[model samples]
Target: RDEGLHPAIRIALRAITDFAIPFQKSSKLYWRYFLVPEAEFTEEAIPQITAPVIEVKKAKNEVPEIKEELQIIKTMPNEPREKIEMVISEPKKEEMLTPAAKEPLIKNPAIEKKEILPEQILDKKALKKEAKKPKPKPKKQKSDKKEEGFFNKVKERLASKSIDITDIIGIKKDELILKVKKEKKEELLIAYNKRKITEGDIIEAHKKAKEADLPYSILNLSGIPKKIQDLIEALKDISSIEKL
Candidate 1:
């Protein structure tokens, strides 16, 4: 049994030795080929990194000194100069006047020699009195003759007949003014009622007559009835009544 166990342990020891020998040899080769010399690497890297840091520190330290120099230049003073000389001028003297220059001379001999009379003295009061006097009265003007009534003409037109229907219907507002004259108003009323004259017709006639500038007095005497007159008034009051 002891000899069998011994054979297994010998085999395990041999395998382990074989692996260690190759690993050690490879490690030595890697270190010798790839790792550079410490002194040479440090010298090159130190200058590259440290040089920029030194320059930055020097610039920071010098900045305050440069600013101090600039401040000294700004605080310096300017120089003074000599005063300028001033000259003043005196005023000129005026020339003296003679007796002939001081004496007055007439511009126009004729105007200076002219004489004044008492009558030539203007009477301002008399002139004002004349102006204030009242003017003479003008004669009254004669007025134009008034237009004749339609009834007057109608009377002649209906001479033979007692009354004519056409005359009544045709009687304009102007003819109605004749009612003021000779009691003709009753005759006009009779005429208007006999014809059965409408308020609308009378209003239309009045409007036309007004447009023509016919006198109001003439329209008043026109033979239209009192009922028709009332109708005209009512028509005027009615808001919806058109001009006709």
Candidate 2:
């Protein structure tokens, strides 16, 4: 019955303040609770991916098994061959002994021990090189300035010049700022150029470019047809233009 008062707002004000919600509880319960209905996945589908096995085919000629047949055999005659006997001559006991064996071998030791290392050949050149292996010298830095005089002098010289020094001083990580010393748009009238391409392709491109809201170039109205190579001064200047 009261004027200018909503029933819900009036009922809220009449609530007990002593038993009010704590400041911490207000923040936690401020958000409305949402009850998400059980998801209906019956209409949804999951794709099944199957792996395909790839078979590699190799040519039989490429196999290296044929290289193992290193030996070649030839057929011999069926007839039995006669064997020849080598002549043997008996040399005297003194003559039979070699120059080295004559002295040492003649005087047989009480214990005939087998020679473990018969001969050892030492290379003097290799031994000398290995023995003289040089120690590595400590690496020295190219520059270790006592003061910043060199850098200060360079900066002072740059400051003296009228040219901007900030252009050169830059971190490589930053993107390069493209600066054109001289920039101007130039227009050329080529109605009289006799060697340029003037064809239906130019008209088609112009229409398409206009519809698509783009800029297009077309060389047209050449009374006499001429090849590009003829007009170019050098062979290298006549680069192959890529076709779109």
Best by TM-score: 1
State the lDDT of candidate 1 residue by residue for 91-205, as single tens digits: 1122113333233332334334567665555576678878999997774343112223344554554454443322222433333322212323222222221344566655655
Candidate 2: give its CA RMSD in angstroms: 47.2
TM-score of each candidate? Answer: 0.17, 0.15
Q: Lowest-lDDT window of 10 residues in candidate 2?
A: 82-91
User: Alpha carbon lDDT of residue 106, candidate 2?
Assistant: 27
Runs in model 1 deviating more than 4 A are 1-194, 216-227, 233-244
